[model samples]
Target chain A: MALEKQSRAAFWVTVLPPTLWIAVFFLIPLGIVWAYSFGHNEGLTGVAITGTFDNYIRAFDPLYLQIFGKSIAVAGLTTLLCLIIGFPVALAIVFANEKMRPLLLLLVMLPFWTNLLIRTYALIAVLRTEGFANWTLAWFWNQGSTLAALVGLQPFPAYQPLELLYNNFAVVVGLVYVHLPFMVLPLYAALDRLDKSLMEASLDLGAGHLRTLFSIVVPLALPGIVSGVIITFVPALGAYLTPDLLGGTDSQMIANVIERQFKRANDWPFGAALSFLLMYATFAAIALRAYLTRGQPADGHGI
Target chain B: MDQLAQRTQDAAAHKPIISFRNIVKRFGSMTAVDNVSLDIMPGEFFALLGPSGCGKTTLLRMLAGFEVPTEGSVLIDGQDMGETPPNKRPVNMVFQSYAVFPHMNVADNVAYGLKIDGLPKDEIKARVQEALDLVQLGPLAARKPDQLSGGQRQRVALARALIKRPKVLLLDEPLSALDAKLREAMRFELSQLQQKVGITFIMVTHDQDEALAIASRIAVMHKGAIAQLGTPSDLYEFPASRFVADFIGSVNMFEGTLIKDGADEAVIACPDLAPYSVHLPHSAPGSAGASVWVAIRPEKLNLHKNASEPPAVPDCPPAHNVARGEIKEISYLGDSSIFHVQLSSGQLLRVSRPNRSRYEQEHFGWGDTVWVSWAGSSPVVLLS
Candidate 1:
């Protein structure tokens, strides 16, 4: 009995610290959010302790539903664009000459070394109405108008420049640029581990280049592409800084709405409900990804 | 099968199936394959035998269309394959690793080439079944490569390569991955399969035993060049140079100077062994004052006790090659004994003798004085 007690003490001593840390940091915050989602909102001051489902019902309101739909659209677009530009670049990097591969990989990751916020702001500097793009447009218009006037014809009607800042297009561009490396790095690693003999076997068996790529390369690389999509899509869905700096009310995402409810409207309970909905959506997306990729063997497991 | 053999016979009657005319392959500053000219007859089992990095695989790859020669050209069926890509070539290769597709089953793997050619589904199925049956793998048609044993995977690779019905089949060390027993079994199986298919078989291997067992003609490669090309027995009996003599099998080489030359024989005084005369078709160049080497196989030297009378010499001449030595060590293999004998000049010579009986009845222990002798025409004289 004494020896059994001593062994039990040793086991608990080894596991207690990490268990306590997880409970305090992760479980406690999740419990607070779950509790707040069920409480009632007070009159513009704070939340009341009365248990209710009113906040959950209000989360599905049409106005908020529109923001949810728009968020999905923007994130989906970002994922699609990243895949289009990243797959080829990753393939080039993985199969390049040994001496050039490291240099190419460094070039791909160069943007991440700088401050991410500074990189996003740099996009604003380039795409703003008075930025380099507009300057070039203005110069083209001036040249065309001068040539028309010189030919003894009336110049084209003057047009005002359009605003590009505070829009959904700028937000999408920022998300794609920020998340592209995430997509490319995983893809490069996956392609690097693929056996070269598999491709040769396919070719020797008389499959053309396109058939080999579609039937063999794509199926083998599906797991990597799925992971890349998840990495780019989940973060873009809940993005706050990009939408806030480069989007107006027309482009407000669920994250921005939650922020408004907490800081501006003083409705902490409703904000907490909205946060729970976002969390549930992210969880559902992850479960769907897992179901799709369950058949793929883990790295180094299958042939 | 008879029809295929007849077709192969007809093809051989017309022209060579594959030909390499002064082929050379260079990678940057390194020359992997020098000027190699060879012709492979149809229905013939030809082997390119060499050590590693001796350009045998590179030569095989050139024939497979995976590589193109930097100089000269490769020909299949008298048509130059200078610019033909691998996919368009009428040849297929079983890669050194087998190169079996992990995602594909045996039947699907064998049918891949026909499917790519857009054949009818029924025809593809029938041909796949036929190929699998040819390799005796019809029962395992639905299994993936990883699910099969090493020998089974090898058959699958062979089936996949042969289903295309190419003019020639290239095997790049196909049995190198099998265990010793399996490798021996597959060597015989591969030879019988080639006879059944009746297509030209070009194999590359470093194992001399494997080459001699399967190949009708063998090309010994050294330093990106063919040292000698002949039948297995021809190469074994009359190796053209010291390289071929030493590479093909175990040989005891003794450096010597030619002392006299006759019409069909020459006497050589070896610095390390007893003097010997070898019969040849032509006298050695610079016969009287030139250096030469005599190669005698270990099994050709006979070891007898000193108390026993020496065997009478043959009609050609007396026992020209004879030496007296003391047994230094004896290795008692179950069926044979390998005796390491130290001669009077302190050179150790190895002689293998059959046990022929129980160890207690017929055995040569250590530290026994022995007489070793050979006939005049036993050793081959290497001029180079």
Candidate 2:
């Protein structure tokens, strides 16, 4: 009995520090946020701590509903694009030659060295009308006109650079670029652990490359794909910087609205309420993913 | 089954199904398989037996179209498989790990190949059921690979591969992952299945016993080359080289110089034993005074307790090959025992004897002086 007690004491000694740290830094802060979400804020009367559901009730307003719906749509699209682009890149890295693999992975992670804000600014430079994209477009237009003249056809009209910045397109492109590594790192880990013999067996059994990829490789890597979806989608839903800088007013997301409530509008209670709504929506998405896959094998390989 | 076996044998007597002609596979600086040329007959169970890194698997992969020979051609059914992708080849493989797709149930896995060919749903289901029944996995069609035992998973792999009905089936150490008893059972089952299907089987294995039991002909490989290719008994009883003699089973070797060479017999003189005369049915490798090894299996040696006592028989000649030794150690296997005897010349020799009649008087024990004798015709003359 005494030895058991001693073991119990030792266990506490190992577990207490992290436990206390989480309680103080995470639980207490979350508790404060929860408490703030129920409070009422009256202008010119300073912040009041009276508990009410007004803030939450206002969060479901049609105006905010549209913003939340748009947020989900954009995040879903960004996640889909990241998957289509990053999955192949991760598989390529896994299949690369031994000596070149590390260099390719390093290039994938090289974007981390630059700040997200600076990267968004750089996107601005290339995406703006007078930027490198426009220059390339004008050069192509000139080449087309020269070809037309040589062919004895009518000369082409003057080149006009398309507006490629400050829209939903730019917002999604920026989000996909920013979170591609998030999608790829997990996918690379899963693909790297896959048994190469399975691929060989599939091909030897008369499955073509594409069929083997979809039937065997992708299904086996579903865990990585799911985690990549979670990592990219959840963050892109709450994205602020990319959408704020690269988006016009029509493309504003719920997070931008939440940011305004906290800083410009000085509605801390409303901001806290909006934050909880976003958390609940993200949880719902995760729960939906889990519910859809509940019948699958728990080992992450089931259909 | 007997009819199927006869039919397979008749088919094997014809032309080869797959052939590797002067095949060489090199990975940058290292040669994995050197200039190997072999023909695999249809409906024959052939094994490439070797230790790891011997390029046996590489040869199998070349036939499966996963790899192209660096210098030569791999031909299938008289067609050169040059630049042919794996899916285009008429071959299927059972992997060492079984490689059953965990995401799919057994039926789906078995039907994967058929699905790739875009077969009708009913036909796919029927073929899957038939393949599963062939492996006796029909009841487990709904079970996933992860939920099955190692042996069951192996059967699923076999079913998946065989459903394609390819011209050849490649097995990469297919039985190595199973436990010993299961491996023995599966070995017989695999050979029987090959005969029943009448498809060529090419297996790469490191276990000589597995290759001996399951293969119709075994090719023993060593260091990226074919060292010897023959039937199992031919490899065991008449090994071509010292490597084959040692690799196939335990052999005691006596290094000696050939003193007498003749058409019927040869005599080799060594310090470990008296001038050993080996009965030869064929020509010897070198003339007299050339160094060679007299290789003898341990089980062939008879251990007698008294060295000086002659047999009671007066007509028969005395033991021609005899070595006087003291029993140093004994290993008690369930059905047999191995006696390690130290000769008067201090050479340790292993002699294996069946432990028949448990209650009988003990023949030999440790510290007992004994005479190890064999027939004059038993020793194999190894040139290298």
Interface RMSD list for the candidates: 1.7, 1.9
- Candidate 1 docking class: medium
Candidate 2 residue spans exceeding 4 A from truth:
A1-14, A43-45, A143-158, A295-303, B1-13, B274-283, B309-320
Report, for every candidate in turn, its global Cα lDDT versus the true structure. Answer: 0.84, 0.87
lDDT of 1 at B81: 92
lDDT of 1 at B98: 84
Question: After aligning candidate 1 to the native by TM-score, how far in Å is the CA of A16 from where it should be?
Answer: 6.8
Q: Any idea what lDDT model 1 has?
A: 0.84
Which number leads on DockQ?
Answer: 2
What TM-score does each model's chain B reach against the true chain B? 0.92, 0.92
Evaluated on CA atoms against the true complex, candidate 1 attains a DockQ of 0.50
Best by TM-score: 2
